[model samples]
Target chain A: MSETIMLLCAIAGTYLWRALGVAFSARIEPDGALFRWVSCVSYAMLAALISRMTVLPLGSLAETPMSFRLGAMAVAIAVFLLARRGMFSGVIAGVGTFIALVAFA
Target chain B: MGQPNHPPGGRMTARAVVRLGLRRGVGLPSVIVMTSMMGFGSLAADGGISFLTALSASALVWGLPGQVAMAELWAAGANLLTVVLAASLANARFMPMAMSLFPLMRGGTRHRGAPYLLVQLLSVNTWAACQEIFPAIPLHLRVVYYTAFASTILVAGQIGTGLGFFAVAFLPKPVTLGLIFLNPCYFALLFAGTRVRPYVAALLLGAFFGPIIYALAPEWSLLLTGFVAGSAAFFFFDVRPTSVSNAESK
Candidate 1:
């Protein structure tokens, strides 16, 4: 099935990076230019992914109003900073706010 | 608390280390991973993905970002290559993570093939834990502790995935949507929590560029945004020697 193939490709794609890391572990400098650049690239990619998901999502998430999604994110970030970077509380607050908004509004 | 029983020396036995690792796995780390995977499960379900497939993604992909990307792209009916590329890009952090952690893990190991299996279990949670815990563990036992710990969390993630997948049937639509939203929320918070300037710059620039580029080219937005924003951040915040040292000091 295509699902299985896609899963395999996903696995392979993910493993490719990990395998490269292991293979080049001895040679690669963790704080060197190459590593730092790669780290930045990954961070940027993740940021892009998250933003796209939040701003222009697919599937069920698109059903919600963009304002609601942005509001939830704002609440989550605010709580996260207020809690001194308590990720658990931040996530719960965000999800809770979204649920309340969706249920009530 | 009473001390754990050990051999004549203070060093723990292999079995004891394994037990400790398993116990650690069931602690706060597993809880966090479980909760996040639960969110992933709900998202997958909302996307009309089957439970088995979702569970397989958690088990095989193991990285949350990559798994989420795969699910989202697949649900949107993207081609296989695009899905693979997007997922891989999202999960590329694992490269630097593994590159850093593998050296510490390789200190007392002799078997080259062992890392291949052990690396498969390395997720963000495990890698972070190992970075903090490996120095205290005996080099010889590092691999064992890591394997046990990582495997336990992997199982926990699978359980969470299953729970989230089925909970959709009983949960209200709003609650399910909230659960699905947890993934992005968590990532955004995690990124915001970092103090690294280049990383922070990259996050902001990427976010700013993400929607704009996405409106123009949905398929290439992620890659293009990453290159443009990441390279900009890298050059602006990281290229200078003084700034590199300044960033590294923190």
Candidate 2:
């Protein structure tokens, strides 16, 4: 079926990068220039994705107001810094703030 | 308990290693995966995907961005090629992630096939957790620990997918929205906690460029933002020091 074929292609496309990483990792040095650049690129890419999800989200998240989303992120960052980079506290604060704002609004 | 050659408390049995991994997996990291996958399940349901198909995509793709892209594209009635391409692009972070992680996992093991299997289970949650935890783990047990940890989150994600699919009709909108928003918040906090200068610069530049470029070119925004911001950060923070040292030596 076409659906199954589509699914397979999706799987193959997604795995292509991981598989390539495995093949090239055997030859690549972790501390090399290439690795450093790649690491930067990966972090940048994750940042871009997170920003998009927060600023221009789809699905249920898109229903919330932009102020709430931005406020939640700001609060999370502040809490993370104040808590000495405790990941749990930051996440709990952000989610809690967003939920409270949305529920009240 | 009394092997003559074994160092005291320096090594553990495979069963004990796996138990430790399971315990670690059940913490905040797995909870993040579960809630995010719950969001994905709700999205898939809204997109008219069957429960089985959505769950299979979660398992097979095993990456939230790719799964979400695939679901959204399929829902929009896009062609097969477009769907595959979008999903692949969204999941491209796995390449660098695996490149970095595979080396850490390569020690004290001779098994050729284990990396292949472990790579399949790799996700953002598992990859991040492994980076934090692998240093404390013994080399021989690294593979087992990673396997147990990743598999636990994978199963948790599946359970979340099922719950979200069924609970969407009953749960309040704000609650579902909060569940969906957890991932971005968690990721932002994770990156904010990094102490590396180049990485921090990349994060800031990427965040600044993301929305602007997205408005201009939605499909290519991620790639473009990475290339521009990452290169700038690399040149300034990483390459400048080396070049200056070389000049001084000359």
Candidate 3:
């Protein structure tokens, strides 16, 4: 029960800024320097999450070896390039390669 | 479709706002968000988070990455502090999102309460859609329109997460596997959609630096890759001359 309450508090804390930002937009311009810094931090944070997923995944993905993961990424990149930067093909290629390798070997 | 018939003042009614939101939100952007959210919720439930927390996070955070990060950390038995830190880091990107819109929305409303409400709609899906659609709408309606559309999705996400949590057993293991993969797959695809030199540069640098940094220091890989790669890409693109930039700028 305490865990649930804590989780709720944390979730609310996380969203407080967004809710607060809009409420105060009359005073804040997205173009202000402070906003720019916020933008930078946001982009940086997004990059961090993406990197962590690719490099330090959890649960089932954690079981997949490093070599296989890297190799699958390479194949995905090659497919992406070959498809002239198509997003769907790149994903299919990467995921397909990973599954195939894992299933076969 | 041509612009919907407007009222005598050339404005949309409250009902119209809700209708437009439901319609526009059912399109590609909302689908992507819903797809990602469903996958995320399922993964959280399968991993042992209660349906309540998963649902509440979607309702509150409304940011998919942060919600996923929080769930993963909690499942891993990390303390509340670590979970918040990781979540805040994932959410730190919102600061930029909020900043970009603040300029556009600054003087439109005299009421002090509106900005706080508007901020809830500032996630990747809403921001990207608003950036595309706001210029087309009458300036005054942008906030109302976005609030309507975003609230629909937010409410949907909350409900979806709750349903996913309790219903995890009904969803097959293969489906859950697919859900776990969806989060990464979406980002990978979205990253590929960028054709800008700097964005492409950031993706490549991130891809290259990510694993390498992890091998060296797993605990700090996310911060290192983002700062190092993103800064390199930012400077490389930002410092170039305007004429050269115009050639590749999109």
TM-score of each: 0.78, 0.87, 0.73
On lDDT, the candidate that comes out on top is 2
Model 3 lDDT per residue over B36-75, tens place: 6776787787668777677777777777767777777777
DockQ, candidate no. 2: 0.59
RMSD of 2: 4.4
Weakest 10 consecutive residues of candidate 1 chain A by summed lDDT: A26-35
Candidate 2 CAPRI category = medium
Tens digits of lDDT, candidate 3, A1-105: 856765665666666656544444345434343343333333444555665665667665666676666677667768877998765677667766766776666
Q: Give the Å shift of residue B247 in candidate 3.
A: 22
TM-score of 2: 0.87
TM-score of chain A of 3: 0.68
Q: Which stretches of candidate 2 lie over 4 Å from their true place?
A: B1-16, B239-250
Give per-residue lDDT, candidate 3, residue B68.
Answer: 74
Docking class of 1: medium
Better model by lDDT, 1 or 3?
1
Name the candidate that leads on TM-score: 2
How far in Å is the alpha carbon of A21 misplaced in model 1? 3.6
**Scoring each candidate complex against the real one, what DockQ results?**
0.56, 0.59, 0.30
**Full ranking by TM-score:** 2, 1, 3
Query: Across residues B35-71, which tens digit of lDDT does each residue of candidate 1 receive?
Result: 7788789878877888888999999899987888888
